[model samples]
Target: MRTIEVFADVLCPFTHVGLRTLVDRRGRYGLTEPRLRIRAWPLELINDGPLDPHHIAAEIAALRGSVRPDLFAGFSVDAFPGTSMAAFALTAAADRTGDPALVEDVGMALRNAVFEEGLDIGRPEIVEPIAVRFGLEPLDVEATSAAVRADWEEGRTRGVIGSPHFFAEDGSGWFCPSLAISRDDVGNFVVAWKHGTEAFIDRVFG
Candidate 1:
């Protein structure tokens, strides 16, 4: 069993795309169980101050157009809020729950809240309902808030460059889902490991 550490920021559409792709390839990627360990790294979408709603909408539109045009097509960017607060909140939630699945769920819900429902995620009041939807306790939300803030500060100190960063046990790193090997590649590796000694050597070393 290999441990894969996933670093992601909730505010990033690329993160969302990466997660969706991973979910779609779970079994194929040998993640059928709880083998993958995801670590949320909060990132700031707006640096100086509050982001303009219009600008956020435009960025969302551009991101959708470039990456997931079909899912975001005809979708109103104005409805979705920016990612900063939500990402932090999720980090907080993960800290308290001890259940990483909760983090994944909340992250997905947060993205849907913005991209699909067009809700403002920056406000705590708006995010509360999403938390409830996940059956999280009120204290959990509060704890998540604190955790996210601390994590954000810590992430900066750790030199976290961006979201969707992946680290493998072998010291290999990947920055995006696009960098992930194909399902066939994973399968071949598994097959070589199980059956062919030379094939396994070639696959792993070459």
Candidate 2:
């Protein structure tokens, strides 16, 4: 199997949409060889502060109104995780376990916990069960944090500009291919499809 690495943050609504699209459409492409290897790109760490729920809420609203009304139906900004470091660590640890399915399941569940189920994933009680269900062994905190930071460093070297950056086996990459975001004159977000985005996905996975 070929691994297509994605650098993303769990709390990011945009990453949620991008990964969900890949998962939902992967089968339709009739290709299973390219498995997603989600990597840590913790936005809080990159931004030097915790993500603001209010800001995320506004982005979600724009996304719902413009692009993905079917998704994020249960999203509540109030339930957003205060920090994604631990969740990123969990995902990095999952990747370390060497099970592609476990990696995908844990990553998606973490994002769903925030965007769909409105759960505060910062709490161990909320995150631990997800790991347990997948039969994941508890990982040491320092080890997992180190793993996440390693991914961040690698992403920086590889030119990951933001969450949901995808890189194919040949090292070609795209930033947030699911949609293109821009700000309007009034400073509101405008979400639209990037031209040839579907072609790009097919090229990577087909």
Candidate 3:
């Protein structure tokens, strides 16, 4: 099976755009079946603390406006999650259910909840509501929690340093990919991809 491995932090806005780009281009890239596998890349764990949401609001808002204007308008400037471990665990737990589509859906829902809907996805309550929206039942928190830890360790060994990282089937990788993101001087937000989606599709599935 052809696969693309992705490591992303739900709290990271670039991850939001990158995942969106992948989904938007999935059909065009002929990405059927288990063509992509997404895992949690916990930025908080790597940095030993939560990132400053205030620092990246402008950048996130700009990209959100371009990608999904309605959702962007709903993004909050005051609310921010302390950690996305619960959210990450949800994705891993979804993957464990042997359903790639569910994993993918969970990832998208979790991201949107935090970044777009201004929901606190770091908690189980918020996640459960989102999960229900996706027609999924509650995942085993303990098991999924362990899965997130494992994913973080694996990513560390692989030299992953940030969120929105992608690894191709051939082991080629990228961080916060272009056309997929933008950042400030401190890596808050600059601008993401406007046209590099096809190039990425070619590299991954061409």
Q: Among these predicted structures, which one has the highest TM-score?
A: 2
What's the true lDDT of residue 101 in model 1?
67
lDDT tens per residue, model 3, 19-72: 776777776666574455788787787788887877557766677656655444
**Best candidate (score: lDDT):** 2
The TM-score ranking, best first, is 2, 3, 1
* Per-model TM values vs. the true structure: 0.63, 0.94, 0.80
Backbone clash pairs for candidate 2 read none
RMSD (Å) of each candidate, 1 decimal? 9.5, 1.4, 3.3
Residue 139, candidate 2: C-alpha displacement in angstroms: 2.8
- Candidate 3's C-alpha runs over 4 A off are 28-34, 62-71, 133-145, 179-189, 192-197
lDDT (0 to 1) per candidate: 0.54, 0.83, 0.72
Residues 3-32 of candidate 2 have per-residue lDDT tens digits of 888998888899888888887788776766
Better of 1 and 3 by TM-score: 3
The Cα RMSD in angstroms, rounded to one decimal, for candidate 3 relative to the true structure is: 3.3
Residue 55 displacement (Å), model 2:
0.7
Candidates by lDDT, descending order: 2, 3, 1
